[model samples]
Target: METTQNTFEQFKLNRQLLNAIEEAGYTTPTPIQEQAIPLALAGQDILGIAQTGTGKTAAYALPLLMRIKYAQGQHARALIMAPTRELAMQISEAIIQLSKYTDIRTVVLFGGVGPKSQIEAIRDGVDIIVATPGRFMDLYFREEVTVKHLNVMILDEADKMMDMGFMPQIRKLLEIIPVKRQNMLFSATFSEKVERLSHEFLEFPTRIEVTPQATTAEMVSQTLYELPNFHTKMNLLSHLLRDEEVFNRVLIFTRSREVAGLVHQYLLGRVVREDALRVIHANKGQNTRTNAMEAFREGSVRVMVATDVVSRGIDITEVSHVINFDVPLMYEDYVHRIGRTGRANHVGQAITFMTFADEYHIRKIEKMIRMEIPRTKLPAEIEMMETPRNEMQDMLREIDNQKRKEDPTFLGAFHEKKAYRPPSKFNQKDSRARRGASSRTKKR
Candidate 1:
């Protein structure tokens, strides 16, 4: 394929911004940026839906910076709303990198730390504000910042914001901002709720989806290992990380910060170097989180463990492998987790640890993704894990019991909390309940 990159001068962007883009080593525009930038520059309301790691930040940021540079006033004209504190900071960093030579000022607002510094930054009169919903609302309500002069608004990762339950905050923000302004909603996927929210914010929007819905990147090679349970997963992971190539730049995604720390400690015991592994999650303070992310990006940390909250906005390109320490709650999350790697035509691997309980979820993921993920056998040392097997089966039974509990007509087959619920007794309500009643009457 021919390279479509031209001198930044061709875009008619401010000379300073162009210099910064060149300095940042962004020679070519990714597909999303190439398609969306022109429309956004023309002052169009854009709804851009593409998988993560497609360079969507520049797709909107470059044009917004250009527009802001060309226009008159300089009072917080642009606002970018991200879902998490980490993401908000990441977007702010991108803006700074892209606007290095320009005189544009930016501020990031998030709740984990104190608000004094953020308030001072806003008071200093910035041209752009990148913020999470909670802290932004707090400052907005306090009248520390005003959107009355806002020119452009961008919602990066709109679906994630919705998934994190920020709809009410987003709606309030929309109502607060002036009616006549440019708006853009960029996300990995557009669910029904995202569409509904967009209708309230955007006027005559141009919708664009770069990738198919519910599909993962084609460049990612996915594999699943049916571990007996958590401990055996740890054993397998220890073995895999021992391979120097795989240990370098590995990212492990867990469900929560507590889990991330636990995994990090467990891995630390087996790994030779203490500095090889780092953990980042929401519970950590801002400085700790920033240091961890920086270490991961600069190649100082070999294996970085994180929760989903920190995963979306992380833009590291050379991540070697993504390990799913815990299966995600939603099938779409599997796609997102693996998306951390194999970005922008670079081949990468995604290894998932599945227990018996996770088997059904894995199957559902396959059905949704429409392809069978290759299964990998555990190493011999980890194979003799009968204890984890029992735990795995017990976990599966627990999940099955929960599903059966949800069935409306499921009658009590046993008494007390000690009762055992078998899969055979768990059946659909209409026919089976009547059959059971008739059988009981015959016995009577």
Candidate 2:
């Protein structure tokens, strides 16, 4: 079947793979897919600077599928590494979905779940292995997996793996994998670390960057709310959710697991649709986290309160909105969080709630994205609560810390005002209740 010169058919993919792409709901090639596929099929290593929810998985997966064609030896022929179990599973699922018209067997291995099932899959036979660095290594050491026959190696979200401190493991994996394989590194932000890793792993790769690194998706309408306190932020979120239905499949990002829990409880307690809310963090069991994410994806759950644990793990693109209940600590995460929405050229929204303490990070995020996040006013219906004493102090401390960074001699502004009242030692509510965060953030 002849397709447009610019379509997936132009890459000369097999009919089975082409049929799978069509069945998988992909009608046209995303910019990254259009550019990256042909190069990958040409057996050139790829350095792709793109994000999830942008059809990037298929860009690398399709070529890998075409090259691997039918299953060969029992050992895996291609290895795909991801930072999180969610991402590993997501990639494996994508490979399965896109290879439906073909006979390639795939297996996903991660640490959170038992390796017994994964072991069985490998023993049964697989052509591709999608895995996290740590678990992949563990499985290899246990003799359940191998990369001896690898034809291609993919690293998705390489920056996230770096942030998760998986460099040591990644270095070791590279040492073991077949040296002659094709290498592909795909990430949302092209940080210096990713650049360095690319040089180490890729052999004169073809560079493909669809958009400027750290740039938000143009289809996403991003807006920020400068709420004074957490309650006001919640009030605004409730207003949008209950009144306006501004978010259909909303992914809410928080800084800590405790806060994720708090937000879930807060919403479940007040919101009429208790069944529509779910939360996940490092604390949740792997199965529970997976179930929550799946529910959110299938629309069984309307909102998912997740920490950075699942920010890069989420694979759905039809998200109506992404809410940053708290500004992220790592500025780059702001890009990944919002990328969850407005994907595949579909328009969506990203709403962030910021307090004074969050202001410092917000400025840094804005600078990284190179565009100001448009500001929106809080609704009059939602009462603006006073900034909690600890939150206020923490915000002031952040400002002071910034000032000190710029000028060594500057004392904290709190020190000059009102005799510097010592914060209450008993303010567990400030520390624990606010997402069960560490002590540093409790000051504000």
In model 2, the Cα lDDT at residue 263 comes to: 84
Say which candidate scores most in TM-score.
2
What is the C-alpha lDDT profile of model 2 across 137-196, one tens digit per residue?
A: 898888778778886889999999999999999999989888998899998888889888
Steric clash pairs (candidate 1): none
State TM-scores per candidate: 0.87, 0.90
Looking at model 1, residue 4 earns an lDDT score of 38
- Give the clashing residue pairs of candidate 2, or none: 259-435, 390-444, 391-444, 392-444, 394-443, 394-444
Error of 1 at 264 (Å): 1.6
Task: Count backbone clashes in candidate 2.
Answer: 6
Query: After superposing candidate 2, which stretches have Cα over 4 Å from the reference?
Result: 1-3, 407-411, 414-444
User: What range of 10 consecutive residues in model 1 has the weakest lDDT sum?
Assistant: 421-430
RMSD of each: 9.3, 6.5
Q: What overall lDDT goes with each candidate model?
A: 0.80, 0.83
